[model samples]
Target: MVTPGPTSPMSPAAWAGRRDARNLRAPVKKSRRPRLRRKQPLQPLNTSPLPGDSGVCDLFESPPSSGSDGADSPAARGCSHAPGAAQQLAQLDLQTFRDYGQSCYAFCKAREGHFHPRESLALQPQVTAESRCKLLSWLIPVHRQFGLSFESLCLTVNTLDRFLITTPVAADCFQLLGVTSLLIACKQVEVHPPRVKQLLALCCGAFSRQQLCNLECIVLHKLHFSLGAPTISFFLEHFTHARVEARQAEVSEALEAQALARGVAELSLADYAFTSYTPSLLAICCLALADRMLQLPRPMDLSLGGHPEEALQDCLGKLQLLVAINGTSLTHMLPLQIREKCCLSPSLK
Candidate 1:
């Protein structure tokens, strides 16, 4: 008989059970029984050992049971499971959102004054209003290159203005601050934000990815995460929808006019003089100016955005000047048909 070898690390009962299970199999002839069989580790039933396993224990990790801790994920609970994409469109009712459009605009209109920048540049020691204008001018073309929505650009400018007042930014970092604001605004509204690498590439690698990310956190924290401010795009759409509903303009005409007005609004965004005007005032003036420039059969009323006549005229004067100054650049921003339809030329006027 072959001498019995040292026992396996398994419990006595477990070893006995294992021996009983092995005995049930066909007995090996002595000539075929290898000597090393006695020295090999006894593996538990129902499990094959992995190549590198030490085999001290045979317990398996299970998925994280929901509500167990209510916070830990499967990965946190010692398993590697990725979660599903979050549902941003859950519980949306398109008809209801459209139906409530006017009411939503009214809510924002009532809050417009709260969002207007008050002496916004007073605290920036290194940055000047001229610098602000130049930065926004560059940003307008950048926004077009990315094909971001007018709302995204409006939100970006709003975010930048709100954050600018909260901290004194260095002139050197103003461009970075602008791009960081764009990123935050895109995250708030766009389906896919531009990649950080791409945005930095636009800057010719003047800023690092970490610097952009760090400034993003600083902006979000400084604003206390409040980003739902009323914007020029919001009020502009409201006025256009109202005009269409009132039958003062054709659907297609209103759309074209709104596009022209959006270009006007973008032009205004680059001028520091226009920042102090409430968004509703600026939006109405842009729409009204667009309609007058287009010479619509029935132009929208100046009172549509609910500003007084005096404020309306004042804002309108500034918008007319802005349009006159940037006529060439604004024309480039619009569709060819829209530019031709609106007569920026003095002879046409």
Candidate 2:
């Protein structure tokens, strides 16, 4: 009991040697639970509830089912579907649309001449307006069949005219040019353009794939890759959107008005007579005519300058006659497409 009772403290070197010996003897076993090297700093408990805090988070809450008819649900409000959402958003901001429409009209007016082909400067013998019209008439059904957009059709015609004006294309190659321009336009504007085979079939295989490709290259080169020019259809759409907002039209009614206006604009596109008229002027005329046909409110208050009421009336008269003539031909040629898209008979009449 007395042994080592009063042992003096060991020197530093001796204590270190004893610790090293103990350490070399065997590895120490660790506890199953991990031990922190240092105690964690003490933190005060949060006794108060968070602002706007509920018992549980919304992340844990179940979402409304797609089939649910709840008014607050996104699906029920038509926001889940792309097309419906687009339409809903389009109709939401009517208050600022008037200013937007005016700006579009003004910009189109300023750059109107730039959009037209060089009519006065004759580089070579070009296709006649009648030939152009015939080619476009054929292209329409093809465009409709492929489900291409109206903008695509407009761009195709633009590409055709710009190419013809700059390059000397023979009458034999006119159809080839038309199809090629359409191909270029489709690729530019469409999400899923008609393939080469489909385009050849549309042409009744009159032109080979190599020929089509060659013509597309030629057109692109001649036009200098300038595809940004706004067509009458572009201005027409802007005016129609503005008119729809101005009149507070129902979606169906707005669509009807747009169809009528587009029908008139398309007539202008087919006839070379409208080449003299600016796209802005054509848009104004189409909108005015559509408004009258739909028995909707007049867009007369819109800022249509650079021409008198008489001039607009005269242009509208010409547009009406062209629509009548084209409507007849359209009925005979692509009757179903025309009827379905333009509602030509009732609207034009």
Best by TM-score: 1
- lDDT tens per residue, model 1, 169-249: 999999999999998988988777789998999899999999999999999999999888889888877777777667788
lDDT of 2 at 65: 45
Error of 1 at 37 (Å): 50
Candidate 2 segments whose C-alpha is farther than 4 A from its true place: 1-108, 118-126, 247-252, 297-302, 328-349
Error of 2 at 253 (Å): 3.5
* Cand. 2 TM to true fold: 0.64
Cα deviation at 58, candidate 2, in Å, is: 18
Candidate 2 lDDT over residue span 41-130, tens digit each: 789655454457664554454453434355343333223211232343454455555557677667767776776775622554757777
What's the lDDT for all of these models?
0.78, 0.67
Against the hidden true structure, what lDDT does model 1 obtain? 0.78
| True-vs-predicted CA distance for residue 92, candidate 2, Å | 7.7
**In lDDT terms, which candidate is top?**
1
Candidate 1 residue runs with Cα over 4 Å from true position = 1-98, 345-349
